[model samples]
Target: MALNYDEIVGKFDKYIFNTYTRQPIAIKKACGAVVTDVNGKEYIDCVAGIAVNNVGHCHPAVVEAIKRQSEQLIHVYNLYYTEQQALLAEGLVNLTEMDRIFFCNSGAEAVEGALKLARKATGKKVFIATEHAFHGRTRGALSVTHKEKYRKPFEPLAPAVFVPYNDAGAIREAITNDTAGVILEPVQGEAGVIIPDDGYLGEIREICDETGTLMILDEVQTGFGRTGKWFAREHSGIKPDIMTLAKAMGGGFPMGAKLAREDVAANFGRGDHASTFGGNALSCAVALSNIEVIKKEKLVAKASDLGAYLMEELKALDKDYVKEVRGKGLMVGMELSIKCEDIVAKARECGVLLNCTSDSVLRFVPPLMISKEQLDTVVGVINEI
Candidate 1:
């Protein structure tokens, strides 16, 4: 028997916590860049699970890897050794310059681990974060996040200082001997895809060296080919002292990791920090396959080519509401002059799924494997709006 949208929504309202303002449609299934609702209406998925499905929803290789690993070994606590976990760590270390990888379950947990590592490594208590940055909602990650709406309710957060996103001078001025690290998103995702100046990250890297501050980058949304490179930091030719990753790493499964330089990571001894499900075999196997898919299919290059085309097409739109069109790779945003709540609703009604973040910016973080024809359809829908 087919369940109706009303029945699904009623169950959610009756049993689940009302945290998110969900769309009207009840999604029944997803494949590639499209999702089908209970009514069997298909919509082009531009949100891509908020940039979590970089290789598209349930890529065959990822699904196979998860199934194979699940049948062999689903999990063992971190106390036990697992070949899947060890292999995934090696893959991450080889992908970046970082020497050690600490696995967690989500981006927020990655950020939290990064913070604790920095403090332990530097013996400092203060951190410097950028304005409008959205690291995560956990208390440690929340402290460094800049949005007051998210932070105001959670008072007495970890000690931190907020500075303008792209201002090198402010970051330099904010740093003190007490500062353990400086954290920022390479491209602020929740702040409406705010891209920094070309040399901003490099400048911060130099300052961190001068002040002995660890440069921590929250690449939860911008990592794993979402930004044309393996990591967005590659665009600036800078290597952060610590990098936090999660979304897309698990190929639709839940996982996160914090990578750091050897000496920085050496500050912690065994049992200093741990997660029961952090390095589970299931997530590790799937993440390994996810990384393999990104490389084997050359999705990074695809994102670069298609992202450029999408940006150009969006910029060509003659809409009066458009204030700016900016982003890197598949993480694009169209800022509007006025509130865009109505625009989002209209897009959904027109068989397209879009996200409105920072109140007025229309965020389009579609799957990296989204087709040109699908993108054309998305643009046509936007044109009609």
Candidate 2:
């Protein structure tokens, strides 16, 4: 039976909450760097589902793993353990020298869980976050998120102080005895993909060391080869005390995790915190496959090579409206002098899909599997748009 997208959209409008300003078309299926609408129109996917599909859409290995795991076991609470969960955890910790892993459900949940763990370790109530940072949308995560529109209505966010990112002095000034942790993104994702100064991460690590503050890096968007590395920290050579990850970990499945040093993890003991669906068989299975595919396919190295090529192509573009093109690896952003919301719509018309962050910067985080020729189409669309 063929599903009618318009009928489903009508039904969705009747039942779903009006929270997101979604695109009009419905994506029925996707493969590699392309997604097809309900009417079967093929569009080049440069957004990669907001950087969540680093391995590409409906990857054969990921789909097969999910299928195999579903037949093996679907759901089991955190009280019980599975080999998939162990493999996923091992894969995560192996990426970084971090000591422990705490499984969760989404990027926001990982942030909340990491916040709780940090507070417990320091026994402090205050936190220091960077200005223009977006941790997440949940109450706890929202409290740390610094956007006024997102934070205004929800007053009295967790007792947190916002400091200017990349300013080591402001961080030092803000960190007092009561400060529990300082959480930041290596490169700001939602804030127009802002990159910090050269020594920002190392400086933050130093400040945390001086103040006994837990340093947390929210690598939700920057993790899993999106920034051309296994993790963005690899570029800086500074390992964080705690790091949160999600988005691409499950290859489109709902999964998030927090990696922390063993000493720091000692604060959260048995029954300290657990998600009903965290570390479930299905999600872990998918994550295991996601990691394996990234490894076997060598998407991490591909991301680096392709990212540099894309950046060069974007930078080489001669557009009066383009102010700059900057980002690491596959995570490139072009800041335009003019508003670009319509670029999303216009790009789609040109048989390409893109995303705009803030009011002017266009973000490009295509799948790691995209070939250089496919990227040429994406770049050509942007130049024409």
Candidate 3:
């Protein structure tokens, strides 16, 4: 029998690191857009594992792929090439429109790999990042991250200059002789789902081209079908020199990768970077299945259609506290004048899961496959609350 919520919490308090400020209820199982708590209460999962379960929880194809690959082989290290790894590499390269791939374990590792590649490729040390941008939590990724609370604990980080988001002039001015590249999230996820202006990314691309600096797009949270397109960068039609991906890559399975253009990727020789379990057979198989699920279900287009409907519905919310409702697709955010934590808790009580980020922004990153009725219910619950 499964342990009850109290039992789980007791074990977690004793064994787990106190890193995350977790939600109260303990999840038992999930299918598609819904998750059931240990008390057998079903909640519409708007969090979607913080945008990792894009294809939805326990997607049949992904589950099958994991099972099949685990039976055949799991990890064989990076010394030898595997068919699953090769296939996934080809798929990701084609999807990302990049020339090369470096598999890693998570978003932070992908950022680390991208940062190192940028420095090695350009023979420079500085990286230009934007304010309110969140890449990851590792040392190198943390340096580019803007929040003082996350950065203050670890000082003397790698060389990176911060610029304001959506301001191309600041980026242009920040580029220096020693600047290796500019790392940015096409749609800033952790910063209240901030979307850039139409011309913002294109202008930055031009500035990077003019200065001979690499453009590194961190699509960790915005990749897959989360932002209407396969990538948020697609909205701007700008190709980044190097790109980092992770969140929804494996469809809830942990995996990440760094992609780079042909010329830029050539700088990383055989021994320069490697990960023991980066592209293990199990992860690659699951990722391949996840990509196939996204394509087969036409989830990209669905996200576009549903995102429009969701935005319209959110904009019609009765609450005067709603300051703004903005997003590209499923990755929508409702900015409220008041802190949204209480609302999040209330939503959970109403059988809907929600996430509050940046204090006042309620982020809504539901599954790409969520039904319109389900979305309406989610919005209605919030409205009632």
lDDT of every predicted structure (CA atoms): 0.94, 0.90, 0.95
Estimate, for each residue in 1-385, the C-alpha lDDT of model 1 and write its tens digit: 8779998889999999988999899999989999999888999999999999989987999989988999999988887899999999999999977899999999999999999999999999999999899999999999999888889998999999999999999999999889999999999999999999999999999999998899999999999999899999999999999999999999889999999999999998887899989989999999999999999989999889889999999999968889999989989999999988898899999999999999999999999999999999999999998
Q: Write the per-residue lDDT of candidate 3 for residues 208-259, one digit (tens) a residue.
A: 9999999999999999989999998899999999999998999999999999
What is candidate 2's CA lDDT for residue 55? 92
Question: In candidate 2, what residue range of length 10 has the lowest lDDT sum?
Answer: 76-85
* Global Cα RMSD, each model: 0.9, 1.1, 0.8
Give stretches of model 1 more than 4 Å off.
none
Residues 281-343, model 2: lDDT tens digits: 999999988998899999999999998899899889978888988888888888999988898
**Span of 10 residues, lowest total lDDT, candidate 1:** 1-10
Candidates 2 and 3 compared by lDDT, better number: 3
Model 2 TM-score is: 0.98
